[model samples]
Target: MVGATEEARLNQLETQVDNGGGEAWEYLCLVRKLKARRSEKVLRHGIFILNSHIARSKLGGEEWTLYEQVAVAAMDCHRNDIANDCIEALSKKFPGSIRVGRLKGMLLEAKGAWPDAEKIYAQLLVDNPLDQIILKRKVAIAKAQGNLAAAVEYLNNYLETFMADHDAWRELAELYISIQMYKQAAFCYEELILSQPTIPLYHLAYADVLYTMGGLENLQAAKKYYASTINLTGGKNTRALYGICLSSVAINQLTKGRNKDEKDSADLQPLAAEALLKDYKERAPEKLALVTAMLRNIKLVS
Candidate 1:
């Protein structure tokens, strides 16, 4: 009892399969579209189509690819029988395929068999340590098992080879933060800022780390970076707005009794922060006002 829209989609795919006119990926495309929709009911439509196609001889070597996709979808739907069928067929056809091994690892992960999943990913890495997908899976398994230390080690090794992966850098930074290692987290954010200077998130994260470390020098640095984030995002960033405000207050406190030269040097920053906060409040007065209310507990004066 598929809906009209999905029934039409299935009919279209069926025409493609029957006429042998769609691209090689027609079935795989259907499986992925259903997966993306994330509806188990709609996903069963995909399983039916795959089974219909599987019973025919019209599909060729590409059918193995179809099996892999269906297997993944089957796992998502918790249809272990269908998934096992696809896996067994794929394993028999390509007994030594690393891609198939990955699918098997994914199946184990789906079943909450973390150690088995990790073992499979580790063996895949041993065969090809540079495989980004396998490396990420290994890291993910480590993190899922609450083994942050092992996850950090794997991520560091991954970045040693793939330094340009901003997501990996961000993940490693978060892991460091969870362990109360602000210095290490700051290093990760620095790497992210170096690679993606225009992104406000990296700037905000780095500013947060520096603000947490809290010294005259770190506060000044944090103030400058928070300002950068505010400017980069055109004042839509509330976190940057709050960051600049707090850093300004903290820096003023730290520099209160310094010499005239040092005071003069530090005075420019609070002015800059005040100006940014002014613009932010102008654009989002209610939000800034609310944030200010929340900040009252800290005894921040205005």
Candidate 2:
């Protein structure tokens, strides 16, 4: 986040704490929260708050959720320089504590610094082999970097390590769709559905790939999936499910080249396309539009 000098200063503070040190972060916490300048004096409190959270986080040989929260706060407040500086400094100060590496990695990954994030995560894995959190982060980095084979491999490992890994299966399914490996993606969704079918997005995602690959025969299955998803999701997310259903219906129309409305074949395509776009927008915040567009493109105009 910050340049060399600030990172060094933060490291020094953490080192003092590590060596049977002081309540520096606490003392600064009481400082005046007045001006918003980058001076060492003003930034010290922020640094202290950041480190205090980190110190509290390192109590056990465990995951440091508090430090993760602190780092996230720094990033969310556009204080990445402070967060990064804090992370780098703490790593040196508390070399025995994996909290520094883990929290820093979490912050970096959240901010889209996948390469650097992956490096930190790799270090954490070496320290704690059974850390499901780091394993998930590794899968995420592989998936985002388009290393689908790697993602698939790591997820398989995650399964062996964690039996109750519902989210891991969900992420695996999503990655399959991301790489356009529809059939495999569908299977992944099916596996997750076995555990948690109530999430509407999972059903929608499953229906999408089925529709993409199976043509007309798949439409019936897709519709069925959408219906189940609707029932499971309930009215709380009704609009979102409706949006996904509309997109699925639009895809079916493309494959069939006509709607259930037998009256106008030529007029159907553009209308279907428009409905797909509308539903996608109404789906609260998701990548349904991108998925819809991709499905729309894999067609034969004949």
Candidate 3:
């Protein structure tokens, strides 16, 4: 296999593999055929043939080149275990090569080997503490595992150095809601909506928190939020609660007249309840729709 005849025959095949040809795969198939026949001489000579060809190519000049080819060949053949093994061997040979670890970790994670991916990513972080990819992956794992507290903490740490991010704000706010921390969630969404004022769902969330406050004034705010939700949804989601949000605002505005400074403190509990259940229902939804439509019309006209 090491003789002049084998070398001369593989001379052209080696050139093909070195040039990133489909022939590289074909050449490997030939090697496998020889191996299955227990021809170690052919296998050894074939590797040397390929290596000599690679010697003239850019990637082959490096020690990692053949290992890369091995990994690629294994992966191309759908031999994931073989590919992963090759990756491990290459990583050991190239000790601390982030690139190898990254590819292997991704493959393991896709295979549902969470612990393996975690281990690889953790090592990458130690070596490159501020690695953005690692940081994002860490946060994603935390979120996927339903560890919202950890997700929040991780995001907060990240945002300390990277602030005013709209997506992060919304994600944390939704997480807060998932835990039923409506007040905190509302505040977070309020900030996001205030900055990106065109998003109505955030306004709807803010209004929901106000409804939970149980006052006519808060009800007015809640009505505005519901109106915004309707405008945004085009009357889709929150349609069921739309009436409630609108009525709360009507009762609040009627009793307290948007006066955040004043509460309807009188024991007019019977009157408030009657107005809320009976009177507010009679007109608020229609009025809110009319008001919202008019606002839209005005915006369009202007």
Candidate 4:
């Protein structure tokens, strides 16, 4: 379901069109701003504006941008005919354009023509060796072909040139995790945390990787990162709360009969358990009993 804010914005865009306003560019931009998954709506409104002489007349230079936008939306909606029309128009206007070539490659990709799309992207790369979009498209092609190893290689090469791309780092991290390369995933998350230290998601992901690695030292480190995640999210993250409990239990087991100073802070487990119980009580009262029993089994609660 759409949120109130999104629904309101969608309604406003519809009203602008219904009133016959020449705000075609504004409408296109607003629709594009909506989530990319709203392809049907984008295609619906885009076709209307593209076909309307009044709207097209008012767009001027933005008409080309609308064509590109509608072309992408059409591909997403599996309307290849519309996408072809837009791409043809763009190709006529901007002959031998690399951007239009990329759209052509994407259309081929949508059609499941792997080798044809690869050829297009390869040629585009030869024209501009450092083209980031084409590089990412290479990775996407590998992924679409179910060649995850190739995807990883392509992404790693992309990162060698653009190390500061946090989104790329995150994508690589997820790829690593999917392939059961936890240590490599941990390294990627480390890069992400160093680049954007304030993001709780990276902290949480790092903690998860560390906890999965499971040694005495790793568990201890995972507890610290989970605590960091909890702090970053203002203690609202239930997964981090559970991480605290799990890692603390593991650490306690590993340090049994060790010196007190070598053990985790005694209050950490109890505090996390308390917070978890309170959260469940307020948010899922029925599940509270199950949570209490689980905590009791782990000796975090009586």
Candidate 5:
């Protein structure tokens, strides 16, 4: 389900439990809430229901599943004692299960044991070469160890197998940006824009990359993307508006006294700059000076 529907379902479950519901109702409700997202509601109510129904009352039916979920939720909430207890129970039940082994790796990861976590993930990959979850965890482990190049290599291999994953593409783009690889970052954003045209952030990111690349053709493409971002978000994006101003100035500088379209395209820079200046002055006063400096640099206003 979508975010709104999931939140609504969680809210409904919260309402049901607050009305003095039964054990089964409370257990299902809290588990569903915890599985959806890590919130204070999950940390508090998950512990409560697990202690009462699962521990004290000795609830059955998918007990192992509950143990795994509660272990993860507890770890996320910093309740290591509860998490350890759940892990102990799960290990006893499924001694040789790779799923349980992955949880063990997660527990090591939570404890800052990077080498141990990577070892576990690597062994898991050896057993099942096509396991996407294990490969992704290996990439995460590399990133957590501050090995960006290794993370990038592993992520590239992972994406080769899972080409349609947008989240992986976004993560790859961020990694490229971290290394100052603007061309690679732009390629990632291009893929994102191709897959999700309506997502304004991808258009803005692509525009920012092109603007940073800084050539006549790149600046023109940047200007077009910035315009698309402004249109997509109904001009609510201040950065894209400023991007239009900056990219137009760069393009006009490159093709001075040659292209009439440069003049026509740059006509909106003054209006966009003025409107953005007013917005920054009112909403983000600290940014007003930067806007003023940019407008003066572009000769859009005195």
Candidate 6:
């Protein structure tokens, strides 16, 4: 079932169509926008819109765009026959077109034809080596085949040419984490933090990686990043709050019997502990005892 917002939007689109006020291009554009937003109803609506007489009459120059859109929607919906028909139509209209070729490649990918998809993407790359889309396709193919190392290699090479791609950097960081390469993951998150300083996700991820790499220095660093995450999120991030408590406890344990200067920000533990207890007391009363017990076990509370 579609959510309330999606149901409302679908109703509005249908009302426009019924009243003859919806232009084919406008309908298609709206459907494409919904698809980009990951609306679950888009596949059915997209296919229906493409087949409507209104769409047929109005998509004179936008015909190929509608075909591509429906092709992708059909592929996602597992309607391979519809996808094939759309791809064939596009191939005939725009012969030797890289965009059409990429669609064909994606179609093969949906059908699990890994080798054939790779070949098509390879040829497309040769035609345009700087194609970011084709490079990402190669990474997807590697991941689909469960070849993490190959995926990493492809992404690293892609980053060599396109270092500013934050999405690619995040993907690389996740791939590194999956393979237990925390140091490499930390490096990727650092790059992401440098590129997008205001994003709390990068700060949180960097803190987690530093915590995983566990040492006095890394524990201290993780505590700092976790605190940054809390600040960026205005203390709404439960994970960041927990991260502060954990990292602070670890740092205090590591710095035991050391100079006061060596203790770092171990003083933040009680504040974090208080925030956590207060959050649980107000929002999750049922879990308050469990949280309190946990805080006590970690020596963050009495």
Best lDDT among the predictions, by candidate number: 4
- lDDT, candidate 1, at 12: 77
In order of appearance, the predictions have TM-scores of 0.71, 0.53, 0.46, 0.90, 0.82, 0.88
Residue 67's lDDT in candidate 4 = 93
Better of 2 and 4 by lDDT: 4
Question: 117-215, model 6: which lDDT tens digit per residue?
Answer: 999998998879999998999999999999999999999999999999999999999999999999999999999999899999999999999999999
Which residue pairs show collisions in model 6?
none
Query: Which has the higher TM-score value, candidate number 2 or candidate number 3?
Result: 2
Whichever of 1 and 3 has more TM-score, that candidate is 1
Output the lDDT of residue 142, model 5: 82
Q: Give the C-alpha miss distance for residue 72 in model 2, angstroms.
A: 2.8
Q: Write the per-residue lDDT of candidate 1 for residues 1-302, one digit (tens) a residue.
A: 23578657755765675565554355446545554443353345445555675543466665676677777777878877777888988899899899999988988987889988888888888878799988898888888789999999999999999999989999999999999899999999999998888888899999999999889888888978887887898766767767767776787677674635445445544454455446658887767666556555434434
- At residue 2, give the lDDT of candidate 5: 45
lDDT of model 2, residue 38: 26
**Which sections of candidate 6 miss by over 4 Å?**
1-40, 257-259, 262-264
| TM-score sort, best first | 4, 6, 5, 1, 2, 3
TM-score of 3: 0.46
Separately for all candidates shown, the number of backbone clashes (residues 3 or more apart, or on different chains) is 0, 2, 3, 0, 0, 0
What's the candidate order when arranged by decreasing lDDT?
A: 4, 6, 5, 1, 2, 3
lDDT of 2 by residue, 170-239 (tens): 7777777777878777887888777776767788777767767766556556656755665676534443
Candidate 1 local lDDT, residue 21 = 58
Question: Which 10-residue window of candidate 3 scores lowest in summed lDDT?
Answer: 265-274
lDDT of 4: 0.89
lDDT of 4 by residue, 1-302 (tens): 34788768766876776577646466668666764355776687788878999978888998898899989989988999999999999999999999999999999999999899999988888869999988999999999999999999999999999999998999999999999999999999999999899999999999999999999888888988999999999898999999999998888788884747544476778889999999999999999999999999999999
RMSD of each: 7.4, 12.5, 17.4, 3.3, 3.8, 4.0
Using TM-score as the measure, which candidate wins?
4
State the lDDT of candidate 5 residue by residue for 1-302, as single tens digits. 24776666666766666566645445454556555664445556555656675453565655566667778877787777777888888888888789988888888888889889888887887878888878888888888889999989998999999999999999999999999999999999999999999999999999999999999889989998998998999888999988988887788788884877676676677777877888888899997888788689778778
lDDT of 3 by residue, 142-202 (tens): 8767788888788777767655777777777777777777777777877788788877667
